[model samples]
Structures are given as C-alpha cells and as structure tokens.
Target: MYTRAEVYSPLQNTAIWLAAWLYSVESTDETVAALTDLGGRHSYGGQGLAALLLDARASADLSSHEPVVRLILWGPGQAAGLHAGSAAAEALGPAGAIVIKAAGGFSHVLVPRYWDDGVEWRWFEEKKRLPEPSWLSPGEADSLLSRATEQAAVLIEAAGGTRSDLPNPRLTVGTLADFYDTPGLPRGVTPRAAKVLARADRVAAIVETVTDRLGDHSYDPQLFALWRHIRTARMAGVADAVQDYRRASIS
Candidate 1:
C-alpha cells in the first residue's frame, strides 16, 4: 500500500519491485507502475525503464529460471565485496547497485548514475567477476536499526529538534522528508524485512535532515561526535535494508 507521495532511491524501488516480479509475487503491470513512478522522480534522458529492463534481460539471458536480484549499497568505507580497482567497484563507489544473478553463475550489476541532466544505468561487463556480498542476518539487521533509531534521536536532540530553518537550496527539511519517505514494500516481503526497511527509512530520513543543518551549528565537540555515530548508523541501516529485502524476496 504505497502512495505516490512516498519517495524511494532508484535502486531501492527497482530492486524491490523487480524482485517481486522475478519471484512471481507481483505482475508486470504492478512492477511497471512502480518503476514509472520512480522514473518520474528523475530527469534522465537515457533508455526508459522498460527498455532498460529489456536490455538487462537480453544481456543476462536468464532462461533456466527466475534470477536472484540483490541490492548492494556501498559508500566510502563499505565496498560490499566489490573487488578493488575494478570498474564495477569504481562505478558503485558513489551510490548503490543492483546485482542480478542468473543460473550457471552468470550475473550482472546495474549501477545507477545521477548526472546534471538525469540518471543513467551502467551495466558491468559480463566477463567481469564480482565477489559475493556479505549479507546481514535478521538479528544483525534488527540491531542496526535499533542503534540507528537511538542515534537519530540523539542527533535530533543535539540539533535542537527535527525542524530545520536552514535555507539550503538543495537540501531542506521538506525536501529531505520528500526524498526519503518510507517506501512501500513489495508483496511477499517477510515481516522482519519489512519492519527493518521501514525503520531504516525513517532513521535515514532523520539523519539526512539533521546532517543538512549541521553547517549552521557552531562546531561543538559533542555534536561532531554524535554526527559521526549517526552517520555510521545511517550507512549501516541502509546497507542492512538493501540486503534484508533481497533475502526477503528469495525466502
């Protein structure tokens, strides 16, 4: 039960909906509607979602059975098992990626790039071999979300509340809320995974909102320490959600 107002990262929405489609939990129409909403949020000029799916399908040639689609999120300290110095690693360094694994050990990684014009999907070469990402267990995911929730509360309190009066053009309280709204989970998602994702999304939204206003506050030693904790927590929560949803899809 997701509304149009809910916002999702391109990779998050794509992985969830596409996995649902792959797992036979959702129809093509449902997946298309979800992706169409995602496309409307961006300004990319590349191939449409359908065309991109077609290309990916053609490239993977997954004829044996439904493939396993996993969402791999990476950042500065987290490589998500990507080999160092590899093209896929370099491309996924900035944002996250979607890995589609077919039969016979065949797979492809789709990295979404955000440019001044819009967003584009970059596919890793099929010949390139990527390491399997280490996924978090249900207990680990729950613990991460719990810590993130606590850290977010501390951050918001240290920042003088969730309301930000800053005048930043790109990031504002309103925009952050809109950008990180609690995404809707696709059908067949496990209850634990759904709970983790919802909590993760809320924590992420709070972290972003508070981080955006950090510039306005004078550099306090305590605030800086709290900032570091919340940032780490946010990253962990996001990564956990990515892997948890994948597990949910396949389970």
Candidate 2:
C-alpha cells in the first residue's frame, strides 16, 4: 500500500499548488477547444482552472496524501472519456506536492501527476508534437500492455506501493464522457450555460490514448471506479455549459 503521505506529500501550500496546477493545463490550439469550457470565459482558461483547483484544495484542508480532488469536463453532456486531477496543498507541503490530470480516447486512458521540485509550472505548449500511445494495433496494444504492466510492477516496487493497485483499468466511451462534473468543483460554474456548449471531440481521442497508456500501469480498482463515476457525472454540468453556448450563439 502506498502511504497517504507518499501520494499527497507534494501539495502542502499555496505557492506550490499554484505552480503545480499551472503545469496541469493544455495550452496548445490542438487541444485548446476541448479544454476551453474548463473555466468558462475566465481570463486564463485551463491555466486559470489549475490555479483555482490549488486554491480550493488548500481551503479543503486535506493533507497532501489525503488530497482534495476535482473533476473537469468539456463537450456537450460530457460525451466521451473521463479524467481527474488531484491537488492537495494541505497534506504535502511545497517540495512534497502532487497535481494530477487525466483524459481517455481511442479506447485508451492516462492520468498524469506532477510532483513539485521547486520549478514554476509550465504548460506543454508544443504544437506539432503528438505522442503515439502504447496500443496502436491489436498486436501493438498487446505489446504495449505487456510493457506497461511490467513497468508498473517495477514502479510499484520502487515506490513501495502495491503493484496490484497501480494498473488502471481500460475506459469505455460513455464513462469517459462523464469525467468533467467533479464532486467538489471550484466556483464559477454556471449550470445554465453547459446546456448548449459545443466543442470538437478531438481531445477525446487524445485522452483515450493517454488513458490506455496509463491503464498499462497498476492502479487501485477503487480509484479506477471513481474515475468512471466522476467522468460520467461531468456531463450534467457539461449539458448546462452547452446550453449556455447555444444561447450565446443565438444572441
């Protein structure tokens, strides 16, 4: 078992959480539209959302190991893969922090975490670079899965976390769509707006590929189950966001 301290160690204060969250967003135009509704018309868009998550995570007062989490979503009614980010400034002070993000596509999945090393967080703004996930074809997916599982086992041994608890499960399309509506979302989400919002599902593919790669690692089943639930729930809020967009379009 990975101690709560290990998972939550890095996120212990405002500055670190803020910096870590900043590194959590997608700044490139390729993934831009998919992440736009993340913070509505907020000045910073996805970057702003990361900052906000850090602030709120601090307010919740959970230890970094016992992190406070949020679910983010885009698209109408949350149509496609689920993702999650965990930020906890309370448990893991500055040097020991953790910030996470995830999305699923191509029947694959990924969840990424950043452990602070005192560097100001920077978004990966690269434009023409796309990573090919582990599972490419039936043959390739199997090979990648084997590699991921083996790597997960090694990581588990190194971290002292259980190998069985690391390999995340495969994601389905419907569950992926519901990833946005988090149980503890930060302020400024307007329910009425998501009803008409529309965004290209291009990012859906990106997330799926990521999740698939992530699933190659070992993960707790409970965590995977939560990912599914939160992933699906975001649609309700997304529905509202969609409606907001439609009204704006009409106006």
Per candidate, the number of residue pairs that clash is 0, 61
lDDT of 2 by residue, 97-144 (tens): 222222221111112233332223322211221232121222332333
Cα TM-score per model: 0.69, 0.21
Tell me the lDDT of candidate 1.
Answer: 0.54
Badly placed stretches (over 4 Å) of model 2 are: 1-119, 126-188, 192-223, 232-250
Every model: Cα RMSD to truth: 6.7, 17.7
Top-scoring candidate (lDDT): 1
Estimate, for each residue in 88-129, the C-alpha lDDT of model 1 and write its tens digit.
777774456777765566667788776545567777754555
lDDT, candidate 1, at 170:
31
C-alpha lDDT of all candidate models, in order: 0.54, 0.27
How does candidate 2 score on lDDT?
0.27
